[model samples]
Target: MYWTNYHGHSNYCDGTHLLEEYIKCAISQNVKAYGFSSHAPLPFLTNWAMPYEHLVLYFKEISELKQKYAGKIQIYTGLEQDYVADFNLIHKEWIDLPQLDYIVGSVHFVDRFEDGRYWEIDNTTEVFKEGLQGIFNGDVSQAIQRYYALTREMVQEQKPPIVGHLDKIKIHNRHEHFFDESASWYQEAIEQTLQTIAQSNAIVEINTRGVYKKKSKETYPSHWIIKRMYELDIPVTINSDAHHPEEVTREFITTAQVLKDIGYKTLRVLWNDQWQDFSFDEKGMDLK
Candidate 1:
């Protein structure tokens, strides 16, 4: 474990720990670099995000920590930019701002309605099947189509450096009862999404947050999606989405082993506006 972890959180957002706590945890874990990616401040985004008012403070804290631990470890600052079409209009302004090391582009809200409000969308068969049936009044297929369309739009428009947890909304559907993964329409949507990601040259993350939640058997993107990604040769990175110190590198080794089982030899890491491959150690992937 050379100690390079890019997905972590702090008191600035929903994370339970402070920035310093996570840094101390990284030092104890012997990690070389730890990146903090709290939920980005979205002006019009719903109440679930860190307010824009805290941006300066967020930077201040990160800067202070960076100075304090300069030689002991590497600390990078970032945000998990939520992929909303309207939000993209000012995306570059935010991405280009000061003190930002990188970003993890994620789509937590599938659609935003009038009044600039959004609802939680579960892109799975079971939840969406029922929710769509009720919310859209029995037009479940249309909802499913819209969900995929939204996903594709995010990939095309945002073109993030890394796609966060490709199939995150499916976390709780381990029994496979939600939507039919075998269904032609669903399968096509997934295939198209993967192709778009590969074409975008974006690194896909094997997020283990859901696994820690105990809601799913596999990490984000699931085995089905991961297998297809392997076939397509799309680049990948591992993230814990940790909100606390102890959770900083949770399940990283297991996730690495899983990737190894699927024939992945290296993982992507960001540096100088590009992603490069780093060899995995399997049993010793996180020895730091």
Candidate 2:
């Protein structure tokens, strides 16, 4: 069995280490394939995303690492591109870069705040509350609906290879403070989004960041969502969304067990320059 993680961050963005450091860590951890998916450059200023000017160097560095580590472990270059309504990877000037192997389309911003700043959903509890109050007038349902709406729109327009953290809006819903996941509206939103993904060729990632980060009790998209995905025949992949070297395979074993219990037999992986499905267990992928 082997492991792969296509969603990761490095110093080029807000991650803690250089790309080389993560490469070395992946090699040590027996990760068969590793991809760097730092936050793509945003049109406006932000702390976590890669600067517009730094994208050139980011592409260059990942390209070099791909060659330098070839034959050891597969290296892929990607970006965690955000879907901000009309502004998305499809509209980015650097979307056509040849070095990019794949993209993980995510929605970190839902709508704008009163000050015209894009509301960030996962940054902090205070910020989330601010957005919830200011944007939706404390209506959690409307805010959650908007988040899923943006995700659906992104899937329709951008059609990225992977969808990052499908139900990440639940990150701040600890103890069901805002609303219950078992609610009818939430389930409907998720089911609708799953229907869209079922129609497209996009793969949903079983992100372990929330679980390992202690932000949530389950993986993004959650167990119920995964079951629905299986029913829809939507492809799925496992990604740690690691920001540090030590986090490369965090909670992967448990997440795999969760998938297995939920009746997932194979996971889509980028292998030999193609995305293919391979059987996996709690340990890792059975490459053979």
Candidate 3:
């Protein structure tokens, strides 16, 4: 059995290693298809996102790696774009360019700080609290509401091919001090967003980075939310959201078993220039 991963990073972004290191590690992990989805250039100046100027080189480098790794693995190029509508990043014409194989849209920020900086929700505990109180006047419900609203808006209008880390705003809510996931309002928001995703062409990715990093006990979207996605018949793909070479397929096998337990029988994979669903188990997919 072999794995297929479409979410990964390299030195071009915040990832620790170069592109080739991830490819070599993926081959060792028996990955048949791997995609490099480094964080795309953002409007704000941040150390994590790739620089806008590097996009040309990012595409150029991935193109070369594909040929060099031919017969060893299938490589695809993608970007983890931040869908910040206020900055018009999501509507930028450059996103739909031919150089990209796919886009994994994510909502990392809700509103902006008084100083015009966007409030990133999944950052450190102090930053998260600052946004919660400063932007929303300490109204946790309102903060969470806006986060999901941005998600719904992105999927409805942008319709990114893959939605990254669906419930990542909860990254700082680890202790449930802000709000309860079982609360009616929280469930309603998730239900509405998942319903929208079910209607759109986007695929929801079950990200394992949160779990492996100990920032979250479960994968993004949580186990119960995943079960709800199954009931809604939402298409899903498992991704480690790897930022390091050895993490290409981190937590993948256990995450697969968790998916299986939630009643998922197939996973969507981009292979041979097409997106298709393949039967999968704890080990990997039955591509043969």
Candidate 4:
């Protein structure tokens, strides 16, 4: 396929593959480009993040892979930086690092009022239902309000090259609890978020991490979000959010076809400090 993946994980983080193995997966799929946007070194987030000590070797290995695989496949060095409550305290210096070809800024935790701490809230109905207990001591709507606020801050402050899974909060709540899917408030929150992204000139990745997780057949942002993106004329890209080689460019043809059906002619690729659109063919990935 003439597609490029911008979000993927490697053994450096919580992923299961090494940089080289991931590359082989991409080449087998015949993807035009592959990017290693593994979770960046988060000193505070020790559980699921890469360590700062590995930063030197991280770049070294990817740089070597990039050179060795040049012309065979376009490789990018990138990171998925989380939007912590105290952004400055955790990310400022790390983002300034030299090897990062791009960054996918994401918000995975929602502020919880139970212990006055941030909790990992993924919008699964069970989790959302349980999460309600800690959100302002059972204020579900308030939780949504604050989650949207964090989304705004992620866009405004981080100014990430791409917004990772804009509506990822709904990943777990698909068929159970609908987050006002037909409500004006929900629509407005999304519209305002899209306006901010468009204004910033950033891309929103169609992350397929959930698909592999069996959470849904959809990616982050889902079908509703993708359709809305078409209305706003926002730019988009596809990422497996791969943690293993088998996931490299996983469901890429399906994702690309879905985008094409929704009026997207191409996906955005970052190169030389700007986005370049790569056109798609109608017959899907030739893989010849």
The candidate that wins on lDDT is: 2
Writing each residue's lDDT as its tens digit, candidate 2 over 3-52 gives 99999999999999999999999989879999899999888989999988
Candidate 4 collision pairs? 124-172, 124-173
TM-score of each: 0.87, 0.97, 0.97, 0.89
lDDT of 1 by residue, 119-140 (tens): 4564445544455555566564
Q: Assess candidate 3 and give its TM-score to the true structure.
A: 0.97
Task: Enumerate residue pairs that collide in model 2.
Answer: none
List per-prediction Cα lDDT, in the order shown.
0.75, 0.91, 0.89, 0.77
Candidate 2 regions exceeding 4 Å error are 88-92
C-alpha lDDT (0 to 100) for residue 247 of candidate 4: 87
Ranking by lDDT: 2, 3, 4, 1
Query: TM-score-based ranking, best first?
Result: 3, 2, 4, 1
Across 142-202, the per-residue lDDT of candidate 3 in tens digits comes to 9898899999998986778999999998887775577899999999999999989999988
RMSD per prediction, one decimal?
Answer: 3.1, 1.3, 1.1, 2.7
Better of 3 and 4 by lDDT: 3
lDDT for each residue of candidate 4 in 92-163, tens digit (9 for 90 to 100): 776777888888898877764455555777634666767777565677557766777887888888888889
lDDT accuracy of residue 27 in candidate 3:
98
Count of clashes, each model: 9, 0, 0, 2
In model 1, what lDDT does residue 171 have?
51
